[model samples]
Target: MAELVRVAALTGYFPTMQGLGADPRPMLRECGLSPELLANPEQLISARATMRLLERSAEVTGCTTLGLRMSEERALANLGVASLLIAHQPTLRLALQALTEFRNRINSTLALQIETFGEEIVLREHFALSSPEPHRQSSDLALGVLARFCAAVLGDGWTPLSVCFAHERPSPSEMAVYRRLFRCTIEFDSEFNGLVIAEADLDRSAARADSALASHARELISSVMSPAMRTASQEVEQMIMLLLPSGRATIQYCAESMGSTVRTLQRMLDADGTSFSDLLNRARMQLSSQYLANPRTRITDVAGMLGYGSIGAYTRWHSQMFGISPRQWRASAARRQPQSSAF
Candidate 1:
């Protein structure tokens, strides 16, 4: 099935492209989209097409940070109904929780996972589209918008410890744009794409938080969203993506995390015409493409990241699914890139 996200994903697309001296209309048509669709933020559109458009736009305009440029002007209001719920939360932690809870309504393919360790917190954002195509632009835009949201709630004094990107670093000019916006350490070609902040940052009180308004917004959202906004299979797929790197994506583990027994979860997936193994394989397929594409990642490490117990097992399975050794796939991916391109 084709994955869909809200039209709001392209909120600043038009002006951003025009600012870079390109006509975005042609790009929209190329991606099977229309300007009319951008006019309605709530409309559902093809997530893959949206990703292609952002990537192609960046290529044509020679603006490596196209997504971040579009994200510069995004305010909480751009989130529509979600803005109310998030903005009124008393703490950054709760606001982010609200954002994650209502994320499917905003962008169905986007997922956020929060991890805490000692005195730090990592806000990991994943854009899990069905295809293994590039998502660099979307990743940048999502992180940029997330930074804006955090700063909004925490006041201007907010600054994360660092921002990480799975993709390699860009040119000096592009790096300047990133440094200016994030105002912190920027790590590229990292294991993940996310923000690292002090754990205390999440507890900072929101100056504008209103319990009354938050309550009203919560009630309104509950009334508007159906209980079946996401399918059982889709939810499990999300869990698999987040847990895959940690080597704990087993059905029993996921079932326990979701507050259900393994048998009950299996029955739900049966109704959806899929199984836990099917979803796990799909997630591995998509993620392996990403991991292998990064030359800095070791094949053995990639195996561990995919939850394989040994290199031989990862190699055999990858060869069966992709018809090539992981090393050969990485070489081919590297060859496909322009020598002049930094990433």
Candidate 2:
């Protein structure tokens, strides 16, 4: 089963209906999706489904620049938490870090890796678990998003130093749009997928990077990242930190919700030198300490939230794991906080 990618949720950024042509329903239908689903702001579709639709639209419309068209519709808020980090960071380095770290919160299958050279920054795309065809389409979509992001960030003055693709040579018209959008040299059939931008240009400072704007942008992006990466393992762990109140936490339900088969998912996790069990235990331990320290949630409710069938089960597990009872742990945590003045 394919996981819902929540592309429609992203319409907060790219909600243009024009140039989409009459009866866009056929395009959604071709992609194995419903046209009605596109109207729902809260709806999500599978990455594979969206890619298939994009490819079909490209072929049907004879427009290889369809990716670019979609990206051009993006509103800055749609980039989510990424927008906040990008807006406030003192330098491009921090901005890229926030992006790389939180990318799964925006799009799970798409990974952005940034390498800084003498005067240029290389942004590479690593697509997750995709077939060759969708992989290519993913790269195209990634490039389009990056181009649009940079354009928005830099405003009218911004242009990529150069653009490169891994696909076959683009046609004259496609190349023209690429050039027009990027306003710089566009190269196709390159070794990797990324944009080359001068370091100096990235630091030039945008007109919209004020502190107030950065703060509001941060809040908006954080909300977007939370939902978008809800199905993402790392982000899910982050969510579990807040969701978990006590005891043992499991990854089974999380994996199922993300639409991943257990064994195959475990294999991919192993490739990352980790396991689902490890992540679950780590999350449990981290959240247990935090919840125990907080006075707001009751002990029983905390245990229940952690999926414990009974208080006894949670207490036993806590004692075995940390050699301390839950009450003792909470007492210790309370002692660490500053005391309130009764006078």
TM-score of each: 0.91, 0.60
- What Cα-based lDDT does every candidate model obtain? 0.86, 0.60
lDDT of 2: 0.60
Task: Judge candidate 2 at residue 135 and give its lDDT.
Answer: 38
- The regions of model 1 sitting more than 4 angstroms off are 189-191, 341-343
lDDT of 1: 0.86
**Per-residue lDDT for 21-89 in model 2, tens only?**
534567776767775666664455677777677666666666666676666656656765466667565
Q: Per-residue error at 107 for model 2, in Å? A: 1.2
lDDT of 1 by residue, 1-343 (tens): 3488888888888888888889999999999999877788888999999999999999889998999889986889888778998999999999998887677778878878788889999997876765587788998899999998998888877889999987767888777779878999999878777899999989889977999999999999888888777778878888888888788999999999889999999999998888999888888888788777767779999899789999999999999988998988888888998765434
At residue 105, give the lDDT of candidate 2: 53
Residue pairs of candidate 1 with colliding backbone atoms: none
Number of clashes found in candidate 2: 3
Q: Record all residue pairs in model 2 with backbone atoms less than 3 Å apart, i.e. clashing.
A: 13-75, 80-221, 81-221
lDDT of 2 at 285: 59
